[model samples]
Structures are given as C-alpha cells and as structure tokens.
Target: MNDRVNEWTPRTRAVAAGRPSGPGEPLNVPIVPASTFVAGGDFAYAREEGTRTWVALEEAIGALEGGSAITFASGMGAVAAVLDLLPAGAGVAVPTFSYSGTRGLLDHAAKQGRLKVRRIDPSDREGWAAAAGELDLLWLESPTNPTLELIDIASLTGGKARVVVDNTFATPLGQQPLALGADIVVHSATKLIGGHSDLLLGLAVATDETLVAGLRAARTRLGATPGALEAWLALRGLRTLPVRLAEQSRTAALLADRLAGHPAVRRVSYPGQGTMIAFELADADTAEGFCASLSLVVHATSLGGVESLVERRARWAGDAHVPPGLIRFSVGLEDPEDLWRDLNQALG
Candidate 1:
C-alpha cells in the first residue's frame, strides 16, 4: 500500500489504491485461486486467511470508505457478520421499510429470540435519538432501498450503541458514512460496485480495530468468503465506480423531475442523488403494467447495473408495507432522452 494513496481524490483512489506497489508488478492484481499456501506468510487457508485477490478488493474499498474492509460472499453475508457483533438477546433498531432480505433476517432472528427488533421510520430523527441509548445496534439505510428515503446519519451517531450504515445505495462516491459519525459502513458490492451485474460480493468497513477483527472472524467462522474471481471482478468494477455513478445519477435526476410532473405518477421518491427512484401509480396493476410496458428498460428484481431496471416493489409479500402502486426504477447508462421516451410510452 502506498502512503501517498491517502492524499488522492476518491476517484483517483478508486483507480490507484489496490494495484501492485512493487516495481515491474502487474498493473492489475491477478486472481490467486489457491485454497492454501505453504507454511508461513500471511495466509494458510483461503477461508481463514484470504488470498491476494480478496486483499486487493479490500484495499480498494477500504481506501474509498476510509476504513478497514472485509469481503463476504454476498450482501446478506456482510449484514449477518455485522449483526453477529451484537451480544445475544441484544436490542436492535432497523428501518421500518428496507431491503426485504435484511428485514427477513431480522424477522428470523426475532422469531428465534436471538435479538429484540424495533422498526423505526428512517425519517424519524427523534425516534432514532430516543432509541439510540437502549439499543445495541442502529442499522440504517440512507436513500433506502425501493423507497429512496434519506436519513440524518450524523444526528443519530455518538450514542452508547454502535451505528452501522448500509452504504449500498449511496455508495462511497455518494456519501462517506464513517465521516458522518457512523462506526461501520457496509456495501453490497454486487450492485453498483460490480457495475455490470455479473458478480455477487459484499463488504463491511470499520475504523475500529476490534470491530474489523470481529467482522473478519465472523467471515472465517461462517465460511462467508468471496470467490477469487468475484473479488477481482469487483475490483475492476470499482475502478470505474466514480464515473458510472456520476452518469447514472445525472440521468436519474432528469427522469425524477419528469416523473414528478407526469399525471400518471402520483408521487416520486428521489433524494436528488444516486441512480434509484421510486414512483407511484394508481395501483399495483398499474405499476405492474408500467413495468411490463417498457421497451428499453428491463423489468426485473435487483438494481444497479449498466442497463436500466424497473419493478413493482410491492409484489414481494415482505414488502407489503410499501405502496402497492410503487415502482422502484434503477437508472443505468442509457441515454436519458431514450429512457424518458420509453418510460413515457410505457405509462401511456
């Protein structure tokens, strides 16, 4: 690792942070597929110690997030690792509406009496502040999934409990949660960090040495290590994250403005940043129709790819609280005018 990397801009750090530092080394870190390395050195088994590929990915992400990072097999794996940091029967506060996967995990834990769960609206600063002292963890999502709601992260930190922010939607380029007073930041690198939707990976970053060690131990004990190829692919995608996010955010803003003025769209939830937007129609049927009617944009479930995707969020039973007419739209690299034209025709 180069000490000079700390001084560069985020964009430059994204591109330059994880490359081989020695003279005449490869420009990109090659995929090291070894499961075990001969005695000594930093690694023995892949699961317990990790490979150079994973190290490269961690270095890049840690540089961008300003913390030590641990990679996982999937986004939920990262989430679970963070949750594992809490003691047994701990009290945790989460967003009332968030990624269904996370909600499902919390529900399962609550059902098993592993933890006490409290659902709080992301915008309720007072509720979060009040609950901060009693809770063991504050799990938050900014520009939340599907709903695209923003939370005041700084306002809720500095309590007795540890604070973890899901930086998946906002991405490191969009915001630095640690700098905003969060103890940890997590990302589903499977989404925007992978850019092309070709890989699945997750990361948890923390400035605290104890928390970082705990997350690494969790990954080892849970066998949640990411594949060598996936880590390499994520690293490649990260190199372009800054540019990709910039273009997508610009187009999202344009579409959001247009959607807000359209009669067919009753409401538009866009935090005025990031590439995600949630727009409401009259009913579930209308929302489904809007998704089905698109030509260029894809009608699908996951988000954050180079191609646009739209889906009726309420279709999932776990997301029943979401508006039946809400469609979560993920803007991509498509020309803004072409995307708007397709959306316009679809709404008709």
Candidate 2:
C-alpha cells in the first residue's frame, strides 16, 4: 500500500501485488483478449510480450518472488523456456526426485544432444556444488514432489551455475527462491497460486532483465503464451493466496501428525510447512483401496487446490523411485476434523 513494499508482510503483498487501479478505472484488471494490439503502439502483438491482463498477473507473482515475472501457457512451457536459455552443448543438473514432467523434458533434450543432463541427489549438497562448477544450469525443486525431501538452496546457488528453482510446492508465500540466491524462480500457477483447479498457467521470475527478455522471446517463438481468461483467473486467485495457503498448510500439518500415528500409514513425510503431505501405506496394493475409500477427499492427480486431493504417486510410471504405497495428499480448505474422519474411515 506504500512505497516501501518490502516492509510489508507476505499476506499484505499477496493481497495487493498487482498494478494500482487508476482513477475511474475498474478496481480489478480487465481481461484484454485481443491477439493483436493497435497499430503503431508499444504492444504490437500479445505473444511477443503479453497483454495487460497477463502483465497484471506477472507483476503480482513477480512482486512475491522479488523479481520481474513472465507467464506461460503451462508449467512445462515455463520449464522449456528456461532450458532454451542454455546453449546446445551446455551441461545441466536437476534433482533426481523432481517433478516427472521436467525430468522427462530434460531427458528428451539429452537424447537429442541439445544438452547434457545429470540427475543429482538433492540432499547431496557437495555433489550439487561440484556439478554447479561445470553445469550451465542447476534446476532444483525444494521439498521435492511426492517425497517432500528438501535441499539447501542457498548452498547450491552459491556456485558458478545459473540457478533455477521450482517453487510450486512451496508457494512464493512459503519460500522466496530469488531471495535465497537463485537466479530464477518458477511456479505452476494452476496449483496453489490459482487456489481453484479451473485454470492452467505458469510463471517465471528473475532479477536479470536480459534473462527475462530471453525467456519472453523463447515463449513468443514457441507460441506458449497464456490465455487472457486464464491469466485473469490466476490473478484473482493470487489475491487470496496467503489466506488459502495459511489454512491449507495448517490443516496439512495436522493431517501429517495424525497420519504418522495411524497403523496403516508406514511413514509421513512433511517439510513442516506448505500444503503437501506424503504418507505411505502398507504397500502398493493397499494404496489403491485407501484412495478408493476416501469419502470426502477427492482422488485426483494434481495438488494445491481449494479441495483436498489424494493420489498414489507411485502409480505414475515416472515416479518409480517413490515408495509403492506413497500417497501425495494436498490439504485444502476443509476442516481438519472432517478431513481426519474421512482419513480414518478410508484407512479402515
């Protein structure tokens, strides 16, 4: 609300991050759905950069990440754009337990000789730092997907490589990667940032203007710009991100604590923050039944939504390293007691 935005808390930033409403203008930003802007103007085409709707969303996310931000059609689109920043023979290192889609993309690029991919254990800070010396890019996903294992991002980013951190699981409210020495911060806005599961969008933020320009050019060439409506929806969800994350995170911790004591649950993995909770059942066989019996929690694939979702992570072919019975639980806005009752019944 004031010139000293950095002095504000994350909740304050989330509620009021975007552009200010001009006098007589709509309180909320209007969606500019035009493919092409007026001739002889600054914005000649939407794909080249973005429209006002997208800019508003970018500014909001950027403000949270403490850098300039760009929106993409999907999370993978943002990932690809970052990868494109590297040269053909560049070496890159990524987490062994990162999001499967990003792993697959890196593997595909490796196969084509576009870049060399090295899968490094996230917990191995020494190995990561060693790789960073030779790598052009180091991609890290803290509290890795499904497993919830965390790495020392500051230590990893101290090396020579350009660091790109995926902060999707730990929303910008939970962790600011840019502040931790990372060169770039990325997020799947479709998840917690959107709060609702209705839209698909991604965001990348960085302090370097040249890198941001390159990412924007890559998005334009690849035609991976986000839709106006999706941008607008994501912006709306972002307005309440702090509130949703607060409730979801509190409920998730409660569920993890209770699940740790359950007989059927072998182990509960929580980073002690964020909305994601992973717990393992007896085996792969019991996982399906457990998921099937949940009355209130929806059995779904994606995480970070308004509704609780439970899914067996090992069912996906890409996540073989994960335990056979691991369930990636995404805590939502539901009451903790109600959620506990559902889990108790489901486990039974």
Candidate 3:
C-alpha cells in the first residue's frame, strides 16, 4: 500500500504492513536486486529508484515507529542522512560512549564547521538540558553499545532540540523511544532489525513528514541506498524478531547474572533489560585471555544474530572512552543452558 501506516502492536505490524498487491502473490515481499528500473511506476530508477523489499520492511518498521521510514546502505548511512539535516553552526549533543562511526561523523562535521557536536554522559539530564540551547539535536543510544548505559530519553530531551534514539539495541520490540517522547527513532537495520548478520542496512523513522522528506533527499542524493535483496532479508528477519529477541534476552540475562558473581569478573552491566550486556575484567590482558578461551561463542565484534558473539569494546579507539577491560556480549538464540555453560567456562 502506498499510504502510510499507524501503530498496531509491533508484532502484528511486522507481518502485515508492507506487502504489495501482486498477481496471486507469493505471500512474502519479493527481493528485487536491480540497479535499474523502468519509469512510469512509483519506483522510476534504482538510484532514485525504490525497491519492494525495502518498502515492505520500511512500512513494517515505520508502522511500529509511528512515522515515515527510509532505508540506507548501512546503519551509519542512516545516521549520515539524518545528521545531514544540520546546517552550518547547528549543534548536536551525543553521548561520549556511542558507536564509533557516529562519533566520527560528528567529528567530521565539527572539522568542516558545518555542525557543532558535544558529548555528555546520557544520564546527565540536567547537563544535557543546560547544553540544549542552540543545540539543534540530541542523539540517544540507550543501553549504549558495549557499556550498557541507560539514557532516560524523556528526561534528556527539551523542546529546544530534537531527540533521536538509536534504537539498535532495544529494537522496536523492546522499547519505543518515540512513544517515550522522542522526536525521531533510528536503527542500524544491520544489527537487530536484520536479526541475522547476513546483510547490511539502516532505517530511520520520524513523525515529521518534512524531516523524513529531508532524510530521503539526503539518501537519494548521496546514493546511500539499500538493495532490494538486503531489504527482503531484513523483512524475513522481522517475521521472527519477536520470538528471536525474547529468547536472546532471556539467555543474555542468565549469562549476565552468572558472570557478575564469578571470581574472574570484576563488574557487570546489563542495563537490566533486553539482550546486550557488558562486564569489565581486572585488566585488558585478562579480557583478551577470556575471549581467547571461548569455545562456542565466536570472539567477534558484531552483535544480534542466531549465534552468540563477544567482542572487546576497548579494541577500537572510539570506545576508548569506556573501561579498557570491558567485554560486550550479544546474546543469540542458543539454548540458555548451552550459552551459560560456555560463558562460565570461558570466563574461567
């Protein structure tokens, strides 16, 4: 359907919202992998062109977000599109512990003098409010990457600046930032939205049509667009997101609770919510050794998949601001007992 959608429960929306009319359709959105397309239809060209797979996923996600949604080549591409809206001198306040690509983009903006970017601990509501003047936007990454920090979004935003939550971790299934009073919601569809790490994609949703138009304009011009095949994969992922997330969340919490009291670990940070969790070792040497000891869980950086994964956040300078011994864990759909057994021995 070409018309926009409003909320139904997210679980309901994930399956129905984006499907297009077809000649005795196959029931699932078709993954069109074309860089070129014929004019005279809604999608003229693949560049300015649109894809059914992308639209289906966008509509489903947008419906849950209660806004217009757009696709990007990757999560950062989605970030770049929204950040592109800031004109010269417009300020952006982001948490210090954020995804590296986001920090890098803000740095580029600062260097170009196109935007003003500042970092604050997300829980500092008073600090964020005080810093809001002339700040065109605020970025929220709750239960932030690797650190498991929380940002009460409703508390951080002021009318003076727009708030955009990076809902990659919580996903729409776990939290609805817009419903919590955010102006915009962003996701690296590459992560939780896709559920499996098979494809790269990004999504942005905003209640404001004008803002969405501007984001689309940026995406269209920069050619940072998602492919139909990838969009379809994301849609396939969405169909099972609720079930996957619930299992992952349960396993993650089980592991987090177990790790916290273990003698080898010094600290744990789970945000006491959905799947992602972090813990700090006594030192980077211990942290690296623990990762090396793992047998079942892959020692890797990315999160949100069917298999458990672990990464040392401090390996990247962007997360350099975090504790040097911190380990970020992305819970998978494995049997909780298997993950618990593997992780406990790994930590030892």
Candidate 4:
C-alpha cells in the first residue's frame, strides 16, 4: 500500500488507494484465482497468504476505516474471527439489540461453555462502563440494527477490555470508529460496503498489529477466506460507496421526516443519518399491510441496496423484542417524491 495515498481525502482514497499505481499496470486489480505460487515469492498458499484481489479490497477498506483490514467469507466469519481472539470462557458485553446473526453466535458460544455473555442496551452508558472493567471484549453497534440507536463510542473506550464496533450500518463514510478510540472496527461488506447486495464478504479493521495478525490467523484456521471474484466485485462496489451512501442517506432523511407526520406511523427511528429507518404502525397486521401495499419499495430482508426494501421487524422470531408494528426500511437511490408517494399510498 502507498503511504502517500493517506494524504488524500477518503472519497479520493476510495477510488485511488487500491489501484495498480505502477506505470503500464491495469487501472484495476485483476482477479487472481491462484491457490499456489512459485517458490521464493511473497505468496505461497492462497489460504494463508491471500490473493491480490483480497489484498486490494483490504487496502481500500483499511484506508477508509483507518486501520489494517482482513477479509472473510461472510460477515459472520468476521465476527467469529473477532470472538476467536478471546480466551476460553472469556467474558463479553454485547448490545441486547443487535444483528440477530451476531446475537445468535454469542448465545451459542455461551450455551457451549465457550464464552460468558452479558447483554446490555447500546445506550446504557453505565452498564458499558461497568462491563469495560470486567469483560474481555466490548461489542457495540451504533445506530444499531433496526432500532437506529447511537452509542457514545469514544466515551466507552480506554477501559480494560478491547472495544469492537460493528460499522456495517454507520459505514466508514458515516463514521470512523477507530478515529474515535475504538480498538477495532468490523463491517458486513455484504451490505453497504458492497452496496449492491450481490456478494458475501466481511472485514475486521484494527490499527493494533497483534489484533490484525490474530484475525488473519483465525480466518486461515477457520477456512473463512473470501473468494477472489467476490473481493473484486466488492472493490468495484466500494468505488461508488461514498456517492451511493450520500444519496441514500439524503432520501432516508426525507422519508423519516415524512413518516413522522403520517397518522399510520406511530414513531420513526432514524438517527438523522445513514440509509436505514424504522417506523411503527398500529399492529403487526398494519405493518404487514404497509409492506404488501408498497409498489416501488421491495418487501424483503437485507439492506443497503440500490432499490428500497421494507419488512415488518416482528415477522422474524429472533426480532420479537422489536415492536410488532415496526417496519425496517432500507432507503435506496430512488427519487424522493416517488418513494414518498409509494410510502404514502402504502400507509393508507
């Protein structure tokens, strides 16, 4: 990676950081599908060394997050790598409301005697400060999944434990957790980073060399390496992340304000930034009706794609804690008026 590229703005760095800088080199990093290399080279086996494609993706993401990054086969893979850093029966503090996949993983580990898990609300500062002294890891998500709750990351760092922020929702463009004193930042590149929902990939970024090495080792041991093509695709998607997120966030803000005024919406959960919003109706039936009534917005799971998506949060058993009438909406690049029209008619 070029140290000089660090001088550029994040948007500029996003496009320029991972490109082949040498004269006559291809403008983009080509997919290197090799699993083995010739003797005496920097790379030997792909599993341990990684391919050029993965390196480029890591370089760009690391630059954006202000740390060194390691790619994984899936977002859960990255989460698992971070958890692997803990010793057996390690104590962990996590958000009571977070991505279900992450919650499920911690629950499974606790059940198997692999970890001691403590669940706390993301906004509970006192609980976090208390956990900081006793826990091995502090896992947090800001503008948390479905709920859009923000955490004071800087206030929660500098304790006995390592702080890991899941930046999947906020995105690096929205916030750089490392800059705010977080020990490590993780992302489900499958979401906003990939931008198109076409691939599965994850990343863990940290300025701490030891943690970075541990994450890499865990990826190798767990065989959670990302595919070469997926890396290349994510890189392509990343090139436009800044612009895409900006437009989507703008649309989200507009919709959030509009939804707050709608009689059908009891409440709107929007942090005033990012592309996600959650609104509540009268009941589960009303929420389902709103999703089914939409003409333009997709009624589906997953988020941060070019096309809007909406679903009743309580429809999923794992998310039963969320209000039965709550609708998790992922705003896209559609025209603000068009989206509002669709939502208005749906609410009626």
Candidate 5:
C-alpha cells in the first residue's frame, strides 16, 4: 500500500491514501509536534493554520470524502465552524434525530438570534425535500444518531440550499455525500475515523475549496486546532478504518437481526451495514437494567471504539426525542457470539 490510491478501491485507499511518497519517508505519518514553526514564512503559528500532522490527516480524510478536509479540536468545534459559515440570522434546517451536541448548539444559537433553525425529521423525506428550497443551508445526518432512520442525500441536495451532510456514522467508505451533490461533508473523526476512543477530533470536507478555506479560517479564529499527537493517531486509525468497519458492520447486522426477534426488545432500529444499532426495551428501568447486566460490553456514552458500548439515549437531557427505553448500541470488533451471550444474559 502506497500514497497513490486515487485509482484504487476504497479498501486499498483506506490503507494507502495519505502516506508520504518521498524517497526515504516512513510508511506511516509522523507527528509534527511543533507549536510554532521557525518564523520568516507561512505556518508561523499552529493556531493560525496547523502542522504537517494535521495536514496529513486532512489529506487522508479529503481523499476518502472526495474533497479537501479541515481538522478541528473536537467534533463540536467542526460543527461550530460549519454553523459559522452562515451569516447571522440565516436560515438552516437540521434533523430532529441528529446528534444532540449539534442540535443543542443550534437550539442555543437560534434562541440567541444567531441563526434561524428549522427541525426536520430524517424519516420525513418529502418534508425535507420541500423545506430544502426555503433554507439557506440544510444540515443532514443520515441514519440519524440514536435512531437509525436514513435520509435521501441526492433528493435533498438537488434543491437550492447548500447541503452539508454529517457523514460521521456512515463514514466515507459507506457513503460519499460529496459525490451525491452535497456541498460539504463533516465527520466526528473522534468516532469512526479515529476508530478508537483515544482522541478528540473533527473534520469537514468540501469539493469547493472556498468553503474549505472558510472552515479553515473559522477554525483558526476560534483557536480550534487539533493537537499534533491526536492528528497523528487519527491518521494511524484511518489506515484500518475499512477493515474495522467491515467487521463491526457484519457483527452489528447479526446482532440487529437477533435483537429484532427477541421479545424483550420493543423495536430494533437498524438501517443496515453500519456498526451503530439502536433498540428499545419496555421502559427506562428495563433499559437501565439491560445496560447494567452487560458484563463484556461497556456502559459508555461515546462510540466507535475497539470495544462495544451501550447506553440509553434518553438519559441525556438534550435528546428527548429519542425514546426513554431506546439504547444506542455501538458494536465493536468483538466476536458476535460473545457479545450475544452478554446481551442475552443481560436481557433476562
């Protein structure tokens, strides 16, 4: 696997996309831990732009997303950069079932008269399509967080608004929103791109270089630059993303089928071919017990790690739209049988 992966398959690209092609360069990207470069030229300060490590990651993600990429300190930072693209009082539409962090930020901004926000239901494809023309921007999260309801990227992108799809859950391998006519694609690289819970990172990719520049400038002004170490680590994780997602998706599909048939599960919301799964129990108490009973799967809030995680969505004060008994399961790289054994015993 080498740096030249443009003509290669996604699997090959995942492992080979951003490697340095110099005669004596290392196979993996090395961390450029400089906060300030030697002055007298551009890249004088890390806060103003970012280091080589960050660029390496951005390039890798850009290749996958079919555009240029920008990295931020965290997922919220990237979200803020995108929102900052809109002028004050501009109109934007977002999914009601999307990530709570982004939703909460939008809600706060709307109340403060920063932006006008309309909540769209991901399952309501027709409504989304109709509202798209009236919006200045359309923010989408297909297979919306918590509940796995998908949205039609192509139909919504055909409208007047500049479409920005949150491609965190689907990742670049699963879906290329940019290719589908979306203006920008964003990811919580802390999740799938990192493929581990070790770092906090976020990314935004766009076919239009101007839009990417705006995000870059916003990140610079906000001082939302990611650390070199985290950037390097994320690049390391990106190499194995294809393989990791394949295995996790496989196990999740298996678990989703079994859980859907179980009497204890009221509903199984799995759109298919992704690691994330959301299912419902009878009530909040039952859901809490289910989480507690799991011995192998950790009871955690974050997802896309090497280990499995399950938590009740309604426990978070922000995501009330999610059912009280709904548990967001993040399937990890574990044996399906072992995970089922833990889940089955926990169900009882």
Candidate 6:
C-alpha cells in the first residue's frame, strides 16, 4: 500500500490499484460468494460484506477520486445513501436536468415530506453558491446527462452544503469530482463500469469519513447490498475500463465531430473524454427516423457497452436540460469506419 494511492495516473490506478496481497499469485481477486466466514475473519458475512468484492472497486475508484469507495445495489442506492446525510425537511439543490431516477427519487422523498428539493441551473456557479446557503446537499453533473453541459466542480463544491456528483455519465476516468472537492461520487455500474450491461450496480466514493460511515450504515440498514455475482461482474468490467474507455472515447470524438458537420445535425455534444455523446438533428422527426435507420448502432437508452447505441433522449422524461431533438450516442469497441458509415446512411 502506498501513502499516495492518490498519486498514480488514471491508467495506472484503474488497472493496478487493487492487487491481492499475493499479487501475481492470483491473477484477479477471487469472488468470495458466501454468507458466512471462518473465525479467522477478515470478513464476517456476505450481507455485512467483505474486502474482496468491493475492496478492489473501492481502492481503484477511491485512488482515482482520492477518497474511499463503497459499492451498492444501484447508482440510486448510492444516491440514497448520500441523501441520508440530510436531515428530515432539509433542502437539496440539484440540476434542472439530470438522470430521471435521481430527480424521481428526490421528488418521491419530497412527496413523502422527507426533504425540500430544488432544481438549479447546473452551469451557474453563482446560482449554486447562492442556493448553497439554504441547502443541505448540492448535486452536480458534468457534461450533464444528455445535454453534456460542463460545470466546474471546483466552483460547484465551494458553497456551504455537501456536494454530491452523479459521476455515472462521466465515469471516474473522465471526471474527478472528489479531487475537485465534491463530497461524494455516485455511479450506476449498469453503464460504463459493467460495460456489457449484464449487471445492475452502483458505487459511492468519498474522502469524508462521515459520508463513508453514513453510506455504510444506510446500505446496511436499508438492505441495499449487491449480490456476490453482480459485484464480481462489475469487478471484471473494471479490469478493462481503461482500455474500453480509451478506445470508445476516441471513436466517440470522431463520430461526434463528423456528425457535427452533417447537414442533418444541428449540434454534437460529447466532451471528448468518455464514450457518451449526444447530438441533435435539424428536425426532431428526422432524429427519430435516423435512429430507426441505424443498423450497426442499436436504438437503446442505456450507454457504455461493447456495441454502439443511439437513442432519442428527449423522448424520455426529465429531459428539460437536453434539446428536444437531441440523440444520445454510446460508443463501443466497434470499427470506427463502420460506425461512421452507419451514421452517414442513417442521416441521409
């Protein structure tokens, strides 16, 4: 263990951070799927959790965020844990447009008279700072869900309230919200981390000991622990994250750039760091037809997979931030040439 798990490059840390003490002896950390443990007990029970399934995810993501990490049943589970930080009837400030689940959960809590929720202009630094005084928690997203609006995390975290980032879209690779001073980073492993979309999972990483303890307590009390199999799949997905990210991001950048120049496209919206991209067509009708025309790219809502996907994000709810014609793209390891060709024909 190094004093600075925090000091390594993203590539180095993503692949190498969670080696078993006997590294090289066992290639990957074995999935310890059990409800019980021996008295030698580094870990007591699977429900209570252990180091193997998540220690790797935690250290790897924590090292990247310069914090400690916790694994959860879904990204919203991690969000629920962080939301536990606020007392009953406390105020929370979040973006006008974010993942539907986050907004939906807050709305659900608000309906239940648990918290006061407000949607702020996500890119407005002063708006965040102004609202921070009244807030118990501040939520942020960079290159936001479908619109890809950029927010300076350093600016967002500056105000009084604790800051929580939905880093699922950006992944831990492209964005370091914790390093920029956010209190916690939450991700839905159903996307980029699981790569194949075969598993449902969530994670939280934080430098604050209080938030870490609170997350553990919430997951424990709420019974949101993931099964051993999903954790194992997420672990496997992570090993190739650096490789997957590099290739997919490279392809996405190219695809977005080419699409931007097309007469049918009104705009392109990927920040060029991760595989997620969103573009809008000149007409909403054409955007629908274009998606229908794609052969190589599947028309799917979820992103971050080994195969490319495109979806009409505006068709989904809470699309206030995204343009009505916006089409989200999730780049995969597919051939860049074929992807471009598919886009060309689809747009035509």
Give lDDT: candidate 5, residue 143: 80
- CA error at residue 216 for candidate 6, angstroms: 0.4
Cα lDDT tens digits, model 6, 1-348, are: 445556778878877777566545576677777878886767877656654766776677777677888888888888888887688998888788678788888999999999999888766777878777767888888877877888777875666788888888788888888878888889898899889989888999888798788888888877788877888788788878889998998988888889889988887877768898888886667888999999998998788889998888778766644677888888999999999999899999
Against the true structure, candidate 3 has what lDDT? 0.83
Write one digit per residue (lDDT tens) for candidate 5, span 42-82.
Answer: 67889887887887788778888889999998989999999
- lDDT at position 254, candidate 3: 83
TM-score of 3: 0.95
Top-lDDT candidate index: 1
Pairwise TM-score winner, candidates 4 and 6: 4
Candidate 1 residues 181-205, lDDT tens each? 9999999999999989999999999
Query: What local lDDT score does residue 146 receive in model 5, on the 0 to 100 scale?
Result: 79
For all predictions, the C-alpha RMSD in Å is 0.8, 1.3, 1.9, 0.9, 1.4, 1.9
Judged by whole-model lDDT over C-alpha atoms, candidate 6 comes out at 0.82
On a 0 to 1 TM-score scale, where does candidate 2 land against the true structure?
Answer: 0.97
In candidate 2, what are the lDDT values of residues 121-218, reduced to their tens digit?
87888889898898899999998987899988888777779999999999988899899999998899999999899999998999999999999998
> What stretches of model 1 exceed 4 Å from their correct place?
none
lDDT (tens digit, per residue) of candidate 4 on 128-212: 9999998999999998888889889988889898999999999988899999999989999998889897999999999999999
Query: Model 3, 87: alpha-carbon shift in Å?
Result: 0.6
Candidate 1: minimum summed lDDT over ten consecutive residues — where?
125-134
Off by over 4 Å in 3: 2-7, 21-23
Worst 10 residues of 2 by lDDT: 1-10
Query: Of the pair 4 and 5, which is ahead by lDDT?
Result: 4
